[model samples]
Target chain A: MQTKIQELRKERKITQSELADAVNVTRQTIISLENGRYNASLILAHKIAQFFGVTIEDIFIFNEEEENL
Target chain B: MRGLFCGTTARNNEEYRKVVKRRMLTMTILIIVGIATAVTAYMAFHHSTSAISDHTLGIYSGVGFGMAASGLFFLIRDFLLLRNEAKLKQQRLEQTDERLAQIRDLALKPALFTMLFILFTSCLIGSIFYPVLIYILLITVWAFLIVYIIATRYYSRKM
Candidate 1:
């Protein structure tokens, strides 16, 4: 899964720490997500989406076709 | 005046540096003391002369062992403190991290399986050579397995 978190966060001029605080996650979690090293849980995904005022689908790009491959 | 001379960041940095320095000093002193005591114990144990009275030899051995024991305690205490401090620091830095939770989940099955495999295999192997020891080990392993299973189930349900 990929996400527009870094792009959106940058556009919003928000620091990773501020985003993490908004989503109730650690800064390391945000770093891992941006680096594509970790996938967020459903609750965390929801929280992140909510914090950005966007739908989860808008933020997270689910690659079902690639997964099938 | 204090705030004018030193901001919050500077004060915090200074306090942190002081704490780290104190910890390093204490650990260094403990290591030196532990080494000295252990060396004294080794010398006393090996260098006793025939001219020394038996009672005096006993007292010397006792004192040496006591010092060595205290030294061992200090070393072990410092080790545990260092490990615990690292863990606490990580926890504080990653207070809401779900990755830590995931890491625990990832580790659980393999650790449990490995422990079970080692205990069961060792018990079976010992049964071939030492029947009495095997029986005791088997009982101990079963007790441990039961406790582990119950605890796992309880935590699974709770979590």
Candidate 2:
């Protein structure tokens, strides 16, 4: 899964730390999500989406091939 | 609203503080018990009339000292967490982080298997020289397996 978290955060002039604080997660988690190294749980995804004032699909791009792998 | 989010975070922080305070109390109790045990072990070791063996006294002393040290370590950590607001917030975030929790869960199985392998090898080596040591190691291995089995069953039902 890839996420537009970095782009969205940048567009909103939000730092990773700020986003992490808003979502109640470590900065490392935001970094990992932006880097596509980690997939956020549903709860975290919801939090992030709410923080960004967007839908989950607007930020996270889920690929069927990735799921198959 | 931002106010609602802040309220929730404040509530969570309060909950974490309560949890830490409870742990500190438990640690205090542990320290007292440890000190009492150590004193008893010391008196038993020094008194000729005591019925307990020296080896048992030594074990008690070690356990008591270990418990005290562990308790002190955690107590100090909790104290620091309570004193430092930034550190407390960071620790709380890290503790509640889903990604870190997942990583911990993923690491646990491999760590357990590695520990079990080390214990099994020790048991095999000790069997050649110290039968009692081998039995103790075997018992530890069995206990670990039993715990794993029981935990699996519990989580399977709960989850």
Candidate 3:
């Protein structure tokens, strides 16, 4: 999953720690989600999307692979 | 991993895996402890009860030594593994409050169970193998249940 969290946060001049606090998650979680190391739950993803004034689909793109499994 | 049941925040299986691993370790330790306790009862203190000081002391020593060894084993294992597990958990802590609370409860129940088991054994294992142990076991069960209920009520209220 690719998230627009870093782009949105940077546009708003928000630090990862600040974003994490606002979203009620650890900064490490935010870092991981932004770096594509982890996926966020629906609630967290929704909150991030809302904060960025974007649709969930806009903020996060989930991709299905060919024979990757 | 991505397709795992996603129940809001409960969908995250990493914490579940970690908790299950801890539980498995605890259960394995408990089984070993139980077997050692049984063996210690049958052999160390029973047949030739005179070689040891007192029959009661012999039984107590068996359980005590078993518990001591078990505690030492887990402490050593936990000391080595807890730091790494905790660190990974830190890196992945998007945990919901409910799941976090459940994890805390899971960690505590094992210790509580161990404490109660030891207490019961030390106080009343003499009646073991005989019908007299039935009463002691019943009383211990009731006592533990009542305590657990009271404790749960208090903590629930606090929460």
Candidate 4:
């Protein structure tokens, strides 16, 4: 999965910790999410979507293989 | 604050070490306090052959018992807290184990851990207690399980 979290964060001029606070997760979680080290839960996806004032679909893009699998 | 990223390096061992160390420290402190209490009690009990005045014996006995009891309580609290923390850590690890697959019991891990820890610890400690504390422990454990079952089920369904 690819997330435009960094792009959105940069556009909003928000720091990782700031985004994490908004999403109610630790800064490490935000960093991991950005680095693609792990995936976020659906609830967390919704949270990020709400924080960014966008839908989850807009932020996350699935690879073809991921989509097929 | 130790490097936030564990880099897939197993953190379970590290966590287990910390908990074991804490329990060891708690047990050591309790033992020291127990020894001091025993020494004081012995001194007071045998200071003289003269039937040890009820007043003096009573005072020393109360002091010794109080110290020992408080020490025991601290040990028990530390054990309980460590047990709770370990359970949470394990559940969180399990929840975050794999993103490739969804697990049905993911949401239930934390509640299961809390209830099981409380129940097991209570039962274990109760086996050696005044037996009255057993009732209180059982009540607390049952109430916790009920509240937990309700809250988790509600969230899992609602979400």
Best by TM-score: 2
Model 4 regions lying over 4 Å from their true place: B1-159
Local lDDT at B39 for model 3: 66
- DockQ sort, best first: 2, 1, 3, 4
lDDT of 1 by residue, B1-159 (tens): 111111111122234344444545665665566556556555655685535555665665666566556656655654554556544333333433566556656776787789778877887888888788677777887898799899999999999
Predicted structure 3: lDDT: 0.65
lDDT of 3 at B133: 73
Residue B73 lDDT, candidate 3, scale 0-100: 69
What is the full ranking by TM-score, best candidate first?
Answer: 2, 1, 4, 3
**What is candidate 3's CAPRI-style docking category based on DockQ?**
incorrect
Per-residue error for B129 in candidate 3, Å, reads 25
Candidate 2 regions with alpha-carbon error over 4 angstroms: B1-11, B48-63
What value does the lDDT take at residue A29 in candidate 4? 71
Report how far residue B112 has shifted in candidate 2, in Å: 1.4
* Pairs of residues at least 3 apart in sequence or in different chains that clash in candidate 1: none
What are the per-model DockQ values? 0.35, 0.77, 0.14, 0.09
- Model 1 segments more than 4 A misplaced: A66-69, B1-96, B136-159
Per lDDT, the best of the predicted structures is 2
Per-residue lDDT of B68-144 in model 2, one digit per residue for the tens?
Answer: 99999989989989988888787778777777777777777787789878888888888889888788887897787
Measured against the true structure, the TM-scores of the candidates, in listed sequence, are 0.51, 0.85, 0.36, 0.36
